[model samples]
Target: MALRISKKYIHPPVSFLNNHFQFLEISEKITRSKIQSLLDEAYESRINNLSRSIGLAEEALSLSKESADKSFIGKSLSHLSLFHMIIGDFDLSINMANEAIENFEDLDDAKGIADAKYTIAGALYKTNDFSKGLTHLIDCLATYKKLEDYHNLARVQKSIGTIYEFFGDIKSATQSYEEAIDSGKKAGDLNLQSNAFNPLSGLYLNQNKIPKALAIIEESIVIKEKTEDIRGLAFALYGRGKVYTQTKQFEQAEQDFLQSIKIHEEMGEKLGWAMSHHKLGALYIKMNRLEEAREILVRALEYSNKNKIILIKFKANLLLHEIAKKEKNYELALKYLTQYVEEKESVINDRTAKVIEGYDVISKMQALELEANAQREKADIIEKKKIELDSFFYRISHDLKGPITSLMSLNYVAKLEVKDEAALKFLSEYDAQANRLNNILDGLLRLTKMSFNEDSKQEIDFEKIIYDCIASYKFLANYELVEFKINIDSKIVYEAEWALVNTIIQNLIENGIKYARIEDGNKPYISISINQEGDVIKITATDNGIGMDEKTIDNIFVMFFRANRKIEGTGLGLHILKRAIERLNGEISAKSKLGEGTTFTVVLPK
Candidate 1:
């Protein structure tokens, strides 16, 4: 018999009303206050008093509609949507969310629309409309990113990760989880951070990385505890309990599961309580506590059946069959076995129907994607011509470099030999122009070479490569005066194309050095940090230098777009760096202030 552990963990959809409430203005102050208070009460009581929460949200909705405040109506509807979702009324949730979206759109509220979409996505996922859920999630993700709403970004990412995990796309799931954690940190929301941490730890545990899994879950537990997120803590404890179970710490596992069940019961979360009891019963079976296992498994089946949780119901039946067989009750064992098989078949049939529906959605998406791809093919033809143009430029730049080198050498010799002051001054100017041309040609050569070169992966010695980059910039002005702080673990193993990685690292270091502030009594510095997280390599370079304004920062990666003209650059460094990162299928971003400095972050897959 194949046993499957339940992966259905809860991550409550965030309340849209709270975030957008300040933006709303109602003519009737008393009505606005009343609606707002009801919404607040609903949100607060969601986990512990779901019915009450739903009642409060409905009351808010009625009040908002009577007051003719479209924004408040939208918020109230969104709240009701979330409340319905918590109780597994997914269809109702989706309906409410759609109505909320309509009201928000009427009010021209972007945040409200996005938040409602998120709630709809959550409901869609619960209803096994995976493709629709994903589409809505993508929309929500884009809106949140554009708004720079890191909290919502993290929430969306975590949901995306969960969907990917459900579909067996572990790699995409891992990346999404990492992104969620990063966004959560940026948002400074500990609860959101821990929410991502819980699922991420499960992924690690699935890979049998026990130590990493344990550490991650422990960190999540700490954060959840600190925030007094009781529901979140219950989930984290359940996760840690699984880790303990895997490591054969039966006693600890049992205690953890019991604690989780206790929390679930207190919070009046029937689903969580059922799931925790099922897990504890499984643990008891593993520990040979047959009687105890049988009792809890029966209770688990009762709750799951009552709630229509088919997955858990079937699983509990299977365990009960095992308990009956062990106790030598052959007839009872046969009955339990038959029930388990029937329920398992039902689950398979239900899953098959959902999968078919999912495939239909995917087929439609693919049709749209195919149309998009046809357009992309036309674009690719133009791109190919551009590549040819770049090839021609590459050859021209390469040929010009030799002559520029010769011209520079001749200029140097002439400067030494020239007798007249006027002639020598002209020679110096000519030399400067020639050198500038040479630098431009060099930059072009590197850029075009990257465009044409085939990617070849090799083990990256980050320590050596970074130091080499720093060493090359020693002759730059203020290079000696600027402090370099490097933090990299020598043991990190990353593999990528050598040239692309070198280009990314070199340009960032050179930018830091070239733009270093040279004021007396001020210490200019650059900090470089590299670390590997799973299959991704993250490199961050920070500098307290002559930073660019917002407009300049926006255009920094454009070819020949100079930020600081006095600094004497080909203006191709950042452009080339960005191209190199793109060539390697990585991401690069910059954050800066006019005076404070800039930090460039590059993320690459290993």
Candidate 2:
């Protein structure tokens, strides 16, 4: 129910190398001129070498400026605008698009003007200026229609529908999406037609039209699969997963989510990876697989945090709070709760600003389009308030961190000064709780610090890291009986961060021993093996323990997830290991059966 159709299922509008953009017609003069070579190469390399494409466009711009050719200048600026937009430099994209539109207008270039306007609309959309974006899209739609450019006309219509969908204008959005689908079919572009089904499915699903939504999504998946569009297929699968989840068909949903994740990983789509992880993790939580939920959510959090994706981070944190509470670690639960609250408030404020900004833009555009100025001033005032509120929230959040740190330091000092035996014992308990709180705060601070830390990559003696991790486990009470079988080629050197690799191996090794089955009939043992294949180093750790089921394996790495509640732990060991592997630009996975054993595998680029 929470899911909606999205433009992300389609390739981003601003990426110039997309098939739709590449097919746009150019003027005869420009096509025949020397500048044509640069433009052609730019288009060809746009997908494979974006920076080079931009550089070529810049060269064309410089030449055009020297020649004082309005046509060349407009086309070059349009290219630059689209390239910038694709790279997420929305402000620069807007400026360049405006400049391109002006030059195109001077030359009476209708197609050029329309292209520039479309780029401007895309920039506005990226910045959450939805009202202005819709205005530009409408303008571009009219131009493309007049020129009989059905391909582009459908593209603009699809974009307009997406905005309307976001604005909750379902009727208008459905109309626009249908128009897009009709146009795409007329143009014989099944791919574009396939695009319509995604949003349509979402719209139907939101209205609880289950059968209709399923039919539409199935159609989308079939079409995309036939076309062999990897990303499209993945998106369709993910959408289907959402619908299945809502319908409480969890087994089917899990399969769909896993299939989508596999494709996303292959395509290197981090956003899709994060989205599916968040969805699947939430599903696990609902199924009461706390361990698996924790694992997947931690992964979701890492990817979301790395990308500054606030929504997923908020969801991940909220679930982590639940997991911590389920484990009876009230201190850790509160820690996650604090982060969830902060992130939730921040996201709410951000969304509020966008909504206000959208209204402000709409009011101003309406005033201009109708040749009235009465409401423009009021709109400007609203915009100003939104900006001010944004700054205030940011400052307040930063300032709040200081008092938390002070409280932690004061609590530590109180523990050190306590004198009476009874009081000392009570103080010791309080100190443990306070330290847990401090650890959570420290984690938040560490995220900020680690973001800026440069990768310290070098040739590492990985076998040493494994042995050292094994050595650290000797300190664990009653853990000496757990046998370790080391199968490592000491001569094999791996290129990675020493600290991260060490941390990953240490945490994983410690987890194997800590969770080992210690019953009379079972001799707990851990098998650590390391091997190199081409440019990758694969490490496997197998343990005979009270292993997890399929669902548990899915979430074993989640933060604060104690799979074996009988063991004493903070539930952070595997979580930390997973995070460390992420830092090393590697991957970690687990396979386990309840009461049998577990096997963890890590793959790192060498």
- Highest lDDT model number: 1
Residue range 1-606, candidate 1, lDDT tens digits = 997765443432346555455445443777888899999988877635677888999999888888888989999999989877766666788899999999989888888999999998887775446667878887788689779999999999999888778677799799999999999999998888899999999999999999999999999899877877778888899999999999999999999999999887766666678878988988998999999998999999987777666668888988998888888999999999999999879767766666566556546756866997899899999999979979998989988888889989989998888999999989989988998999999899989988888877898898888899889887888788889999996778877789999999999989999888777566899999998888888999999987878899999999999998788989899999999999888999999998778999999987
Which regions of candidate 1 fall more than 4 Å away from where they truly are?
A: 1-59, 89-92, 108-110, 127-129, 352-606
Q: State the lDDT of candidate 2 residue by residue for 35-121, as single tens digits.
A: 768977885565335678899999988888877778888889999888777655667888999999899888888899999888888
Superposition error at 583 for model 2 (Å): 72
Kindly report which residue stretches of model 2 are placed more than 4 angstroms away from their true locations once superposed: 1-106, 123-129, 248-252, 258-273, 287-292, 305-310, 349-353, 356-606
Predicted candidate 1, C-alpha RMSD: 21.4
Estimate the TM-score of every prediction. 0.54, 0.46
- Candidate 2 accuracy as TM-score: 0.46
